[model samples]
Target: MAPVVTGVIDAHVHLWNRATDPQPWIDPTTMAAIDRDFTPGDLERMLDSAGVDAAVVVQASNSAAETRRLLAHPSPRIAGVVGWTDLTADVAAQLDGLDPASRRRLVGIRHLVHIDPDPDWLARPDVGRALDQLGARDLGFDLVVRWWQLPLAATVVAAHPGVRFVVDHLGGIAESDDEAGWEAGWEAGLRELACRPNTFAKISGLAGLVNGGDGARLRRVVDVALDAFGPERLMYGSDWPLAELGAGAVAWRRAVDELVGELSPAERQSIMSGAASVLYGLGG
Candidate 1:
């Protein structure tokens, strides 16, 4: 096979020590398969072999300590980390609780909004107040919301003029859904969200969205995101560990490459590496 694209960064991944940590979400089908820990060494080899240079290690749990553990791994492979925190918690106090170095590695904060589908959560007094504090701190927020919840997501973005928001996994589009029309509403919402200067999007998780390796489904999703967020605000992520639910590192890279097939070389590099480098403060 031709050499896989070099210097590509799998912007999102997770490196966990299952012995010390428990992730309740790993697939039951592969529980026995992935029950063992996956270390930085495991991830580095995947990056090296898959032609990926760096990655942003996102939190698999709502633990600040998880961010610290990944940061202490002593590997240059993890360029940044998108960690979890109770955004509704005492914002200043929670930020202070983070280890100094871990906070430095943080590119953004994320809460599992996918599990909490309530539209009012976006405008809830405490949640909205906490989000304002995030904007004051100049940190990004990764919106992990479902497709049906995207309209509320747009509302949240519209309300927060200063906070930078990243919509993950194309709003978690179901791969079985027809591309053209089924995507229109969410696409419209993304386009509306993009009009806000602070909102960005990630072109990741294509593998998990499909049931049987439907590349066409992935293509439609990518096209809409690229059209909405443009190359500048868009970044690529592997959603590893989670990505293992669908495919391995090598296969994931191929799918990402194929999705961006029509882009110019520089555009591909931005989605693959450049945008993430700037966002996460990971200098090349």
Candidate 2:
């Protein structure tokens, strides 16, 4: 049976108001479930239903304005904010420009590298310098990449040992017709990336990756992640509204409980909350 875990902190949740900050990537027809705005109240209800204690809200767009709005959002459940900054520009100046309170709330930064046109965008020298700035400021970088981009991400993670990296969505498996080929590449890249001690992986977004939200397939992926990252470097994230597209937050939480059932109480606690708390500096 799964060990009971309390004070669960979801490391990857997104909140957006489409009118102010648009998510152009969201296809209205296919992604009708999450087409509307997701308010702080909505987030609270979701967390309450899923029994999640708190969450780290992640930026959905590349806009700095969106990040500011998230930082200003009066959500008590938001333990940290992972905002976005222009990696090609003066990252330090832009981040330092934020007011002190906003700065305190900020824990990390991210870019939609998966949708970026440049396949080698993460490897750019300017971006590398910007990442160095984040490290200096004691901030983390969230890597949201596609399956094929895992190796590239691994290269960057290796180069920047100072910058803490949280690999979003198990590095994200591609929905390819050639499932075996893509899975092989993803696993190989993910394992290689895990070799870096500065890196961590989120056990979120897997429900959407598997067909029919198969529990066994999800368990297999989680097991592979455990073997590579162990419970210490692994964290749980609901991926929330996006997860609604898969099995919904409550179901995903239950699935995770089942997946990690064999782990000891302390190990389960690490994945459920401990790892994220340490990574994001969420104090007890």
Candidate 3:
């Protein structure tokens, strides 16, 4: 496979040292592909093989401890860290307690709002206050919500104009036999969030969203996202080990590169690296 997108800053990735890290989300009985230890060393080969020079390590668990571990990783491949923190608690104290070194590495914060039973979990006053704290630190925030939560998420985004919000997985895109109506609704909600200048979209996680590995539908989703968010506000991400569950790591990048190749080379490169770099403050 030819590597068209060079030095791609994979905007979303998760790395866990299973021997020491507690991955409450992984079930060994089911997810055999990624149930074992996956360290920075393991990811290095994949990045090297796929022509990805740098990446942002996103949180898998809700523990700040896991975020600390990722920050401490010695891989130069990790350009920034979107680690986790308890958004409901005193976010300022948590930011203050972080060592100078980890603080510099902390580019953003995220909570697994996708699994939360409450649809309006992000609408709480306490949660909004904590997210505002992130802006005070000049940090971005990753919104891990499903399509069902888009309306609530838009409300939160509207409330905080300072925080840069990165929306993941084409806003939780999923495939169905009759996706025409769903796609229209999804695009409408996505447009509402995209209407906010602070919000950007990560064009990753398509593998988990589609069935039968249809490239055409994946390309269509990319096109829709590009139309909604535009290339400047969109970024590429593999979702890594999680991607191995659906599209193998290499295939995901290749497929995304194929769909995005339609854009000018400068535009493709911008989505692959420049957008993520500026969004995460990963300076040249």
Backbone clashes per model, in order?
Answer: 0, 0, 0
- Show where candidate 2 strays beyond 4 Å: 1-6, 176-180, 209-213
Whose lDDT is higher: candidate 2's or candidate 3's? 2
The count of backbone overlaps in candidate 3 is 0
Stretches of candidate 3 off by over 4 Å are 1-6, 175-181, 208-211
Ranking by TM-score: 2, 3, 1
Report the backbone clash tally of model 1.
Answer: 0
What would the per-residue lDDT of candidate 3 be over residues 1-284, giving only the tens digit for each residue?
A: 00122377988888887666777678777777888878898788878777788888898888888888888887878888898888888888887887776578888988889987766789989999988888878789998877767888899999999999999988886457464567666777788999999999998877554435676777777888899888999998989878877866787787778888889988898899878876787763
Each candidate: what lDDT?
Answer: 0.74, 0.87, 0.82
Better of 1 and 2 by TM-score: 2
Residue 114 displacement (Å), model 3: 0.5
Task: Give the C-alpha lDDT of model 2.
Answer: 0.87
Higher-ranked by lDDT: 1 or 2: 2
Ranking by lDDT: 2, 3, 1
* Candidate 3 global TM-score: 0.92
> Which of the two candidates, 1 or 3, achieves a greater TM-score against the reference?
3
The Cα RMSD of model 1 versus the native structure comes to 4.6
